[model samples]
Target: MMRSRLTNAPARLFSTAVVSAPKPAATRPSSDKGGGGGSGRDTLGRRLLSLTYAKRSAVITINKWKEEGHTVRKYELNRIVKELRKFKRYKHALEICEWMKVQEDIVLQQGDYAVHLDLISKVRGMSSAEKFFEDLPDKNKNRHACTSLLHTYVQNNESSKAEALMQKMSECGFLINTLPYNTMLSFYISNGQLDKVPQLIQDLKMNTSPDIFTYNLILTACLPQRDVETAEKTLLEIQKAEIEPDWVTYSTLTSLYIKNSLPEKAAATVKEMEKRIARKNRPAYSSLIGLHAKLGNLDEISRIWEKMKSSFVKMSDTEYACMISSLLKHEKSEEAMNLYEEWKSVSTSGNPRIPNLFLADYIKRDQMEEAENFYNKMVESDIKPCYTTWEILTWGYLKQKKSDKVLECFKKALGSVKKWIPEGRITKEVFRNLEEEGDIEAAEQLLVTIGKAGHLSTEIYNSLLRTYASANKMPLIIAERMEKDKIEMNDETKKLIELTSKMCVSEVPTCIS
Candidate 1:
């Protein structure tokens, strides 16, 4: 793999034609039979055309010309497919290849074979791609194919199979290149097969002496398991090899220190990272915020935020949200509210209240009215609230024992998540809660409203049964409701209903019945 002389010169050579004369348009008349005229083909063509420029149309026209008995050279097709592949037009490219395979007297060169295998592998047909490799002529079995195949297996979580193939390649007198070896080592590290690192390192060192990437992989593998002593040893080995650690190395060390509850070490690593790198980066700041937040050092987090406010490494929405949430978590409600108002005033593009951090802060202080006002402001600004926000508001109102506000919040939440939830469960839970508070008429009205909406779940039926059992005078109404709703009670729910019925008859009913 590390021969003084490069053997596979063709792999580096520009085999693809850099400049080719464009073929004249096909002379044959257009026909719907072989072209994309059917529903499936039309759909494919439409999607292809939707991309920027009419690139998809070029692909379809090229394929159409070939289907209509017009001569199309391999170079022409390769050029179009290459462009399409760059745009992630995988499905379209695959369709073109499948069509080409059926034509007469067409030979796919090694480059075409490699590209086809890559496209297929991306579409999750690695087994089919492997079969394609097996069918390749001896001359085509080069480093590119082997490396790509190994990567495919690794991506698909078939590391054992990838290892077998690597061993087979070596047995056949094919030298395993650094590319494949590095990929395999990284795979081993990612999958927690750290125990195998010694053998891998020995093999590489004896053969090619493992590059910077190989050492970094070994170091990261040590970090995740909190083997800090081993990590330090690996860093020393890296320095002995005269290979300086890169951002990945520094970031991994910082993350490991933070994970092990050593914030001071993590912070020191960040300082080293800043000295090593030419410019500041986001990861260092993110790690700082995370470490400080973990240590409950809000003052340090705030200082970092201030330092990064106008830095090149800008704060992302989630990062800003995290800072506000941290302030709230530490009972700095006034500071959180002040920051929220400041962000709102400075945000020129959109509504700042869409994020839940402000709502969370208000709820932390048991200020339901303020939270509700913020929610209303969000609605008035035409910013669509996510399901999470609705869920938070619903639960928050329930905690405050504000039944009317809970009802309003539930209605708002239902508008967003109703289609995704079991209709019966929402209706049953709402009605059951209402009836438990002695609002039987309101519960029945809500039941009628949700029944008009859509299908309900069995949990909703159970809630209705519980509500009726609690009333002690609605047993017949419960049976009628279940029958009318066409709800098939599961065995467990049926047992509960039976047990509740017996209890309701023998004693004063409870709200949970």
Candidate 2:
């Protein structure tokens, strides 16, 4: 069952007192009655019970009963309506409420009237709820009843309606409390209407002094907007007004500082939280870990992780993955591997990121077989290898002159454009190695492949052109191809082309020889 926020009223008010009203005894109906008695009541009673325990079945039953000639009383109808509203069955609730409205001589008590208004408010039919409230007899407009109507408007995001109700309550000599004001302020903040916050605070200062929740509400609103300067000023004002900052206040400040890229300040706030409250919350540890990682302070990250581990902080899978990757980045692969092994041992629930990090470590150590094994393991675990993983495997195959494997990996890399690919020195080395091994055909094919893929550079083009020229076959043809491809040639390249053309002409021996 979903708990209602409104149900936090004092226990004394909520307790049900047994009434002394007389119970009506069951009597056998006359045989001439048009509707059957025992069977009909039993079916209706079963449907009513289903409304509480089995909602869908209950809806089907209720509709079936209504379709038949059964007359559902206002009290019984209201019970179903209340259940529907609680379950967020707005359409059904509306249908039932409209049906109830048409029945004559059905006088609803104050509590039932409030429930109707609440349903109307929840459905965001404010005009309907307003009309209902206005039609109610003046004698029934008690403080609690008016407050319920006010909260209905608030829940519907209709602050102006709630304010009008508050004014009416004040006119009726009801002592207006901070609840409505806090609610309105929260609405304004949640909707990103920060300009309304100061005015609300001013109104509370002039009329009823603001409470801690009021200040906290303002701070919570300000945090996400990155309005830390205003939040800080508000904190000082809160302190001057004798309101002590709670855990929520500090947490908001920590998060705000982190958002503004002030990790040092965020860390300081976390320290303050640690000292001010002996017991810490989950967010505090999360903030610390995030801040330390952002600062590139792996030592501090390790310290915080150790503390969290000892204190039994429930680290999320993402946090665990980040820690492992950080360790691998710092070349503490042994420690990372140990942690990965431990995590695998304890965690029945699998995460792909851990294996991905392990695969990265294997690539870094030039352990291609081990890396391929991890990739296979990832596939077995139903974890799809990301594009970076494929890029790593591609480079590994290229280094080992595995042309078929290279082609396979290249396709995978191209599938995801955002993943990293080798550039500059490493790419030059791949081409150079291919050319030296007398695999000019494969090397030229790769050049065209990379050029089509937009990864080939002028240096790579020049290197391939020089190799072809040295072979003394189709130097002019290759040069013309480079020109047609719009690849820029430097001084050395121009001179090489001229010299190769002359060498090709001279190598054809004269007829006298």
Candidate 3:
């Protein structure tokens, strides 16, 4: 289960060597007799899945499959592409789509173009995807493509763009189905725009019938507002629509009941959740375990865990994480640690998130030794530390008053994350220690890194100035740096700059140089 780190390249710039001119058929692999279903031999899908590096191209695999004289069909290719997307192999998926487009013998359907467009939005950017959509022929700009672009807008939190796209979709009469509406509802609920759900539901009823997914999200919207009455009404609406509620429906209701302090009703809903749980649906099991824990039914958690073990031949990392998290919540650290060891033995994905959970708990409990040991274990096992890992370690070092280690971990934390704003309190504490230690160089590095992440605040700039002033050093280009960072100079900043100037002339020979 070694995973490839995902990287985004231009979707259109795939390998053309194999795609444009494949090898002779005589050089075809002798092992691939008939590359059809149910043969159980090595297939193209397996080869594509085996690629564990971002730089490797799926196009090479497809071209090699062609050169091997194997039968290739659009359906098979589409299936492989779908599976690749499911595994978060967006670059590989887009490569397959790109190869399909260049095939003169094959004609892509509307759905294929839609998937390609969606992948472009992911691998490239929204603007590229928008251009792609705009260039599509009128018929190809069907519900799927429009909805795909709309989904991109929602994902990017471009609310105005999303709304405009939805309006256009309605005008094009694409609202006859619930898919687009479901995407919108998901966007609204996730963005905390709960008040918009009812109106959207009204629009949904007017246009198309609400399905189980629709009502499930509607129920989810009710939970945060503690609106049990609305949740019940939504459930009734589901019944009227003759749509059976799924596991998520029951799970949301169970949570709502718990939130409203109707424990008996929550208990009843938990039973309903169990009835709806499909044998292979792991999320349902996780939800049920969480609900049971919320109801103070500790025994039920063990029973559910056992049931999950029996149901799945192998537990996924997510399932392990969920169970570990639930156990930790109930003060079951010993049991959680046991599960962590079990997961370590079997886990293939070097995901840092699971390890971060234990690191967080250990740091929270002030068990720095255990936290350090577990973190070292993760590093030994090739589980690269994510931002949360470093953040947890930083807090642990903060607790120990190890200023140097705290700043070191803080820098690593910032480096691990793509886009993050440092917490004001943590930043303040780190700078205070940095100023005391007179580590002007370290303070400057942190400031530059924070500025690169687009969070160089006035307070941060002031902190840096204070560090320089306290160290009897002059920040020679302080004015230029602040102007460039667009940090407005306050009275304190002016005073610090003036004071440091005097100190440089009077006391500090190094600063005068």
Candidate 4:
């Protein structure tokens, strides 16, 4: 059953492959030895990184670089591929790797092959990546390449393939470290195969040593079940095994403590987590701010926010969003707005994520006027409002009993979303309001919008029927429309059809009195 659920899960669970291969150090081409190209020309790597994620080819760029009489070093090309992978430009990364395969001067190592296989998995799919792995020369099918394919299998939720590969790796003596085991553990946790986790951990202990990452995965598996007892035991085991508990370990424990309502333990764990925070680790700082927010430690949040601001020359939108969200959780809107302004000044792209936060706060407080103004201001500033923004506006109008505005906002929301199913509650409220007002045209328009979203249900059609019944108007095309939409008729539909059939257009009033 759990395996069934995993089978139905979507592919590409990870944006990038999870492998233990560290990036090679950056090395400039020897051509850059004399005062940076002398004509202010960019390096091959720089030109490659500058290419957009559109339908462009990295091979074309490489050819152009070679035409400029520049030497294309293998190390520089590898660095650029890594950078492209970092930015999630999988398509271009694969192109570059494919180009490297044909260059006489370029010879790919085992690690390069691993990276290539990983990129193929991301750009193409699991099947293509499997073929690439199978076609690799016998000498190139080393530990790294095998591990890379295992990552692809695990991420794609191909449990059988991953298990078979793991067995093969073990037979080949490739399971020398905890990397492959850790990958499987991650897959188990994500797939909700918790019962399999402990057994896997046991296997790791018996077959190979469990590293800190392995222990971290074990602790993470304990989270959804709120198994605090197991988490504490694992922490102790980490200490006994002499594996240093990193900030991630303590951050996770702090969350567990908070979830179990042990605030004191959480607070103490937070201190330990902070103790392990590296000066340049922004993620750790964010974790600290988030944990402090959960503990309602506003003072600690402020202290950590200041520390983070001082540590980095520039803060990312994510960092600002985290702080603003934390402040908002404590009802500190003033501080949140200030941070939003600071973000706006520095933000290059007019991302609507930060603006939606304030909009949500305003709507929650029944401040529709402020919400409308804020939405308009965001649009004026060229920030495209996402579905959440429109959904917020729709709910606000629903609360005010403005059916017209509610319909307008719902249409806008539908336009922005690619595939969205209307929530039953909001759908009920919107159609009910329109039905009560006898707005048959609005009801039909809303029905068509929802039908286009591909979520038309029996109840949704019934809402339109109810609007027809309230208006005492016969819908002549009801049967044809239901058949076209493939909605099966039920008791309610039969009753409404019978009722409308008896209502004569000559006898009924043309308009509601």
Q: Which stretches of candidate 4 lie over 4 Å from their true place?
A: 1-42, 53-56, 64-70, 138-143, 157-174, 418-441, 457-459, 462-477, 488-513
Candidate 4: Cα lDDT at 390:
84
lDDT of 2 by residue, 1-513 (tens): 111122223212210011111222122222212122354455454454334332345445655887998766676666656555555655555555655565575666666666766667656576666666666666655555566666776676665555555554444444345766787788777777777777666655654677878877877887768888888988898889888777667767777787888878887876665555433465566555654555567888798788777877456666677778777777777888788777776666576667877776776688889888878877886666766676677778776777667756765666556544655655565666555553445556666667666665567766765555655533436565677778778887777666666654322112112
Off by over 4 Å in 1: 1-50, 53-118, 123-138, 158-212, 278-285, 292-354, 358-373, 387-513
lDDT of 1 by residue, 250-284 (tens): 76777788778887887787656545544345656
List the candidates' TM-scores in order: 0.54, 0.41, 0.80, 0.81
lDDT (tens digit, per residue) of candidate 3 on 1-513: 101122332222221111222212011122322234444567886777666676899888888988999867888788777766766778877988999998999998888889999999998998788888777776677778878888887787887677666665665566777888899899989989887777777777777888888888989898789999989988887888788888899999999999999999999988998998888676788889888888889899999999888878898888888888888888899999899889988988787888899998988899999999988988998999988788888878878878768878997888887778667787888888778777777777778768777898788988988888778887777788789878899888888888887766333224223
| Top-down TM-score ranking | 4, 3, 1, 2
Q: Pick the candidate with the highest lDDT.
A: 4
Please give the range of 10 consecutive residues that has the lowest summed lDDT in model 3: 17-26
Worst 10 residues of 1 by lDDT: 12-21
Model 1 TM-score (2 dp): 0.54
Model 3 clashing residue pairs (backbone): none
RMSD to true structure for each model, in Å: 12.4, 18.1, 9.5, 7.4
- Candidate 3: C-alpha lDDT: 0.79
lDDT of 4 by residue, 1-513 (tens): 111111222222222232222322222333332222334576676666656654877899889878889788887777777777766878877998999998887767889999999999998998788788767776777778889998998887778767766665665566677898999999989989899888777766666789999988988988899999999999999999999999999999999998899999999999999999998566899889999999999999999999987888888877888899899889998899888888989888687888888888888889999999988988988899888888888889988989889999999998997789667888898998888887777888898888878989899988888888888877766888899989998999989988977765422223211
- The collision pairs in model 2 are none
Q: Number of the top candidate by TM-score?
A: 4
